[model samples]
Target: MVGLLPRFRRYRLVLLGLFLLLPLALLLGAGLGAYPIPPLTIPEILLRGEGVEYQVLTALRFPRVLGAALVGALLALAGAVLQGLFRNPLVDPGLIGVSSGAALGAALFIVLIPGAGALETYALPLSAFLGGLAATLFLWQIARTPWGVQVSVLLLAGIALNALVGAGIGLLTFLATEQELRSLTFWTLGGFSALTWPLLLVGLPLALLALALLLPLARPLNALALGEREAFHLGVHLEDLKRRSVVGSALGVGVAVALAGGVGFLGLVAPHLFRLLAGPDHRYLLPGSALLGAILAVSADLLARTLAAPAEVPVGVVTALLGGPFFLYLVLRYKREVYRA
Candidate 1:
């Protein structure tokens, strides 16, 4: 622990910087769009409340920006928890089939549902959250044994579930109308253009629930870092930790995909970047990942909306384009570290 002092000191600085950066991300996200408002004047414009600028800012950008940050924070937080729980750098919420399940639900909703009613609007995201949560719960049950949940088995189950969801989506695609097809295609690619207060309301409570479940697991996760048996001897409740971790990841990724379809690599990238900078202390890694994830998501979203001028690129594509190379770097680095060990 003495050796970890310098690192923690550095982490505090990083944490402080990230806390500062988060609201800036929010301001920038709200400010720059098709109808540009100066970041500094956002507060003023919102206060006036009766002009086109005010309307645009209040009715449109604010909810989407807030949802983007929430989605990113949730995904990255889930990723951190899963990575720590599994003790695998490669693990993420996707590794347990939650994301695919949510995507599947969204696809199903788009292709089959015919109403634009309030109930339907609310149900689309609700269905998505339930789909992902159910899939993760099923995987959890399947991998459970008299001994304990098998991490290897859970991983394999997730892979199978993903493949199954892919097939299900393809069938949904086959049945969809051309318009529905277009909508789902855009959704799968991911964007925040359509987010609003109603949609945000659907996800807000569940996102909070996910946060509540995972944040408290930080210290036990730190214990698990020592080794499973060592952690068990130290009185860490491994089974309970694993269960909550899986559930939290499901809730988080479900809400994320529901709001912004399949925004990739924020999860894989954010926590990993913080781990590189500050060591793998869950106390810092969890919240640090959430903040960095918000920053990355906001920046990527800003580029998506502006780079084409009235024609928005999918935010998921933006995240993928940004994160793909970093992912490769991580793979190579992981290989080198494994070889050294």
Candidate 2:
């Protein structure tokens, strides 16, 4: 214990850096948009409540920035929890088809709703949240084992659910009116600029509640990383921890999907990146993941807004493009170990 304190202190310093970086990147993202607002001027306009610039900064850019930051942090926090839960370095929030399920739900609503054109703007996010939660519950029921949860079973269920949800989304797309189809397709691809103050008001509370709930579980999560039997020996309740983790992850991811439409890989990458930088104790890992996730997401949003200029590239596409290659590498590197297991 004595020897570990120094190492822990060092890790804390690194996490402090991540916390500071989260807001810095958010401000940077907010400042750089189609209008090319300056970063330094953002705070002044926001604080002083001046004229037109203030409105742009407050009404539009500020909300978007906050939304992105919250989504990023939530996804990353979920990722850290999930990776620890399964003891798998490759796991992400969307690993188990939660994102697909959410997409399917949103698509189905768009297909079925009538004369609800104006509501269509916000319908997808709501649908996605419901879909993600339902799918997680369904997966949980199917994957529950008498001997305790099996990571293999959980992952397989996610893959199967993803396929089913993907197919449903596809069918919805095929049947959609051209206008609805365009909207649905863009949303499924994931982007963050759709944020509005009202939407943020709804999402922020849910996100905060989820994060607050999960934060206390960090110590238990770290214990579980030592293996279930070992954790039990250390007085951790296996079932309770699993319940909290699954529910918390679902809640966080659901809200994030509601806001950001199936943004990918931020969860998987952020936690791991921070773990590499700050070490694996959940006390550090969770917060570190949030910061890194924010950095990755806000940076990605910046790229999405700027890369195509007037026509934005979907945020999901950028994450997939970056995350896909890295995922492939992880698979290849772990192939032998996976096969042996």
Say which candidate scores most in lDDT: 1
Per-model clash counts, in order, read 0, 0
How accurate locally is residue 258 in candidate 2, as Cα lDDT from 0 to 100? 85
The superposed Cα distance between candidate 2 and the true structure at residue 303, in angstroms, equals 1.1
Q: Which sections of candidate 2 miss by over 4 Å?
A: 1-6, 145-151, 332-341
Q: What CA RMSD would you report for each candidate?
A: 1.5, 2.2
Considering every candidate listed, which one attains the maximal TM-score? 1
Give the least accurate 10-residue stretch of model 2, judged by summed lDDT.
Answer: 114-123
What are the models' TM-scores?
0.96, 0.93
- Cα lDDT computed for each candidate against the true fold: 0.88, 0.84
Cα lDDT for residue 87, candidate 2: 89
TM-score, prediction 2: 0.93
lDDT of 1: 0.88
> What's the lDDT of the predicted structure labeled candidate 2?
0.84
Steric clash pairs (candidate 1): none
Model 2, residue 181: C-alpha shift (Å):
1.6
